[model samples]
Target: MAAGAPRIFVSHLSGVAVFDPAGDQVGRVRDLVVMLRMGQRPPRLLGLVVELATRRRIFLPMTRVTAIQSGQVITTGVLNVRRFEQRPTERLVFGELLDRRVTLTETGEEVTVLDLSVHQLPARREWEIDRVFVRKGRKGSAFRRAKGEALTVEWTAVTGFSLEEQGQGAESLLATFEQLRPADLANVLHHLSPKRRAEVAAALDDDRLADVLEELPEDDQIEILGKLKQERAADVLEAMDPDDAADLLGELPTDEQERLLSLMQPGDAADMRRLMSYEDRTAGGLMTTEPIVLRPDATVADALARVRNPDLSPALAAQVYVCRPPDETPTGKYLGTVHFQRLLREPPPTLVSSIVDSDLQPLDPDADLPAIAGFFATYDMVAAPVVDEAGSLLGAVTVDDVLDHMLPEDWRETEFHLDEEEVATDGS
Candidate 1:
C-alpha cells in the first residue's frame, strides 16, 4: 500500500451507512451529492448522501474519509442532513485525503491516526484502502502511552472491526500465552517485561499455570505463586502431577506451605505430602503414580482407549504394559507391551499376546536417578514403565523428570536452547 494513491470513487451506494463512534447505525447513503465548479470543469463530490425526514439529504466530503473496508467507509466529521444541505460550496480532491488526522473513538477510548497505505489487488487490478495505523491516546492528554506506563486493558480492549481497519499495535501477546508449551513458556518468560509477565500470568487459569510451573525455575515458581491468591495457588499445586506439586510446595515458606496444603483438595494434598516425604532428588520423589496398566486378559482395544484418555500426558510411550489381576502372585506372567504406533496397522481383534513386543526393557523402582536418565539418552525413550522387585507394575518415569536428574542444579538458570538441526536429526 502506498501513500498519495488516487482516491477510489465508490459507485454503488445502496448499502453504505453512516456509523457512529460506538458503531451504532445512524444513516444510510442515498445518493452522490456533487459540488459544481464555476467553469465547464467536471463537478466534484461535495459529499455522499444520507436521506433524513422532511425530504432532506445530508452530504459528507470525500476528503474526510479515513478508510474503507468491504462495503463501508469511515469518515472524519459527524453529519446532520439539514446542516449538510444548507452548507456553502467547497471544492475537495484526492490531494486533501492523504496524511489527514482522524480521532478514532472506540469503547470511549480515543485513538489517533499515524499513517495509512493503499493496496492494489492483482486479479481484479483494482485498488482498495488497505490499512490505517493508530495509537491509543493517553488519558486527559493528546499523547499516547509509552514504555514504563501502567496501562490497564480488559479482554475486549480492541474491537475486531477497528483492528481490521488499522493493522498496528493490535498484536495480542496475552492471547498467545495458552499456545506456549511448558518449556517454551520457561524460555520466553525472562525476556518479557514485568508488566507483560504479570499480564501473561494473570491470563492463565489455575490448570494452565500448573502446566507452566513444571518448566519454570523453582525461584520463578515461588515468585509467580506468591502473586496469586491462596486459593489460585493451591488449585495450581493440586492440579500439577504429585511429584511436581511436592517439589514446588517444598520451596514455599512454612506459613504459605501450610495454608496451601489446607486449601488443596484433601486427597490431592495427601498425595503431595506422600511424595514430599521422600528426598527431593530420589527415585520415589521423581516418579509419577499414573501409569497405563491393563489386565492380562484385556484386549489391545482396551489399552488403546486408556492411552487416549484426556488426562493422559502428551509424552509418547514406548510400550503398553499388560499386567495380571491383583489377586495373582506378582509374576511377569502377562504378555509384554505393544508399540503404541503399531496398533494403527494391526487389526483391532488381534489378541494382546500376539501384538506384545517381548523384547521391551523395564525400569526398576529403586534404580539410581542419574542411571534412569542415562537409559533414556541410550534408548531414546520419552518414558519407561517402572516395576517392583517382584515384577509388579508400579509407576512411570518421564523424560522431563529424567532431565531434572541429569542436568546440573544451575543448568536452567541461564537461557535454554538446542541446535535445531541436531534436534531434527535426533527426532528423526
Candidate 2:
C-alpha cells in the first residue's frame, strides 16, 4: 500500500453512503467502475456508481472524489445526473472482478479472489487497483487444508481470468451469485450477454434458478428457460412456486407446455395444471397450492414447525389452514385458518382448531382480480385461502401476487424518480 494512501477493500465500500462537499447525502456506493488497460497494467479506477434514494444510478467520476474514509465517500459535489452506462472497455469491481479465480504467476496455484484493495495514487487525484485478497484452494473442498489467513498479493502478481472463459471463470462467477439475493442476482443476470446468462443459469441449482427466474422479467424468464434442457427446465419449474410456474408455462405453445409438464413430478404437474385451469386474472391463477395445511386436530407446535420452513414465503408462513383428512389440495374439507400471530400467543399444546378464524370466508377460485383485491383490503390478511364450490381448500393467494397483477404491465421496466429537476452541484 502507498504511504498514507486511503486504501479500502472494495467489499467495504459497498453500500457506503456518498456525501457532497456541502455535507449533504447524495447516495450510496453500489459498485466501483474501472477501465481495463492493455497488458499487465492494473485497471484504472473510473468512478463510483451511486444509487440515489429514488433508485437511480448515477456516475461520480474519480475527479469528483475528494476522500475515501469514515464509512462514507466524499465527493467534490460535481456529478453527472445521467444514468451510469458501462462502456465496452470498463468493468465493475463487485459484479465482474470480485470472487473470481486467478492463477498465481509464481507457484501456478489457483486461488479465489475474495476482495480487492484500491489506493489513491501518490501526487495524483486518481485511484487504481493495488492488491487482491485471495483464499487458497477451490471452493467447498473438505480435503483441502484451511489457510489461516488470506494472501494479499499485488494485482500484477496474479493472472486475471476473463469472464468469457467457459470453464473455471464461469463457475467462479456463478458461485459468487449464490451469495446474492435472488432479486439482486436477477439484475446481474439481466445485464449479462445471453450466452453468459445461459451459462450462469445452467450452473445454478434448480431451487436457486427458480427463485432467480421468478424475479426476472417474463421475456428473460422464457429466454433462459429455453436454453435449459427439457428435463432440467422441468425440474426448475417443479421447484418454483406453483402460480409462477404456471404463469411461465402459460407463455409457451400448448405442445411445448405439455412436453415440459409431462417431465415434472406428478404432484407438481397436478398443481400446475390446476393453476392453469383458471383465467390469468382469477384467484386460482394467483394462488399457490403449496400453502401450509394441517388437520384441525393438529397442535400449535405442528403449525409452528410448518411455518418455520425457510423455503416458505413470509406471506404463506403467516397463516396455516386447518382441514379434514388429506392435507394436500383439494384438501378433504375446508375448515378454518390459524394466524401465526395467534399461534405465538397460545401454548404449544393448544389445539389449532380451537382458535381458528372461522368467520374468515375463503375466496372462490373463480373470483376476479378486483374481488380478490377487495377481499385482501377488507380482511387485511397477507394471504387468503381459495376454495372450490364444494368447500375444498384449493390454495392460498398471497398479497404480493395480487399487487403484481395490480401494477402496470411494464412496471418492471419503469424507474421512479424523487423529483423532476436535477440538483446543481457546487463544484467545491
| Best model per TM-score | 2
Candidate 1 residue lDDT tens string, 74-145: 665444333343222222222233223334335554543333333334322223333445455443334744
Candidate 1 residues lying further than 4 Å off, grouped into runs, are 1-172, 176-178, 193-196, 309-311, 314-316, 324-336, 341-345, 351-361, 377-380, 389-392, 413-428
lDDT of 2 by residue, 149-191 (tens): 4789988888864334333344556544445788778777766
Worst 10 residues of 2 by lDDT: 419-428
User: Candidate 2: misplaced stretches above 4 Å?
Assistant: 1-168, 416-428
Candidates in order: C-alpha RMSD to true structure:
20.7, 18.4
Query: Which lDDT value does model 2 have at 101?
Result: 78
Listed per model in order, the count of residue pairs whose N, CA or C atoms clash below 3 Å is 2, 0
In candidate 2, list every pair of residues with a backbone clash: none
Q: Candidate 2, TM-score vs. the true structure?
A: 0.60
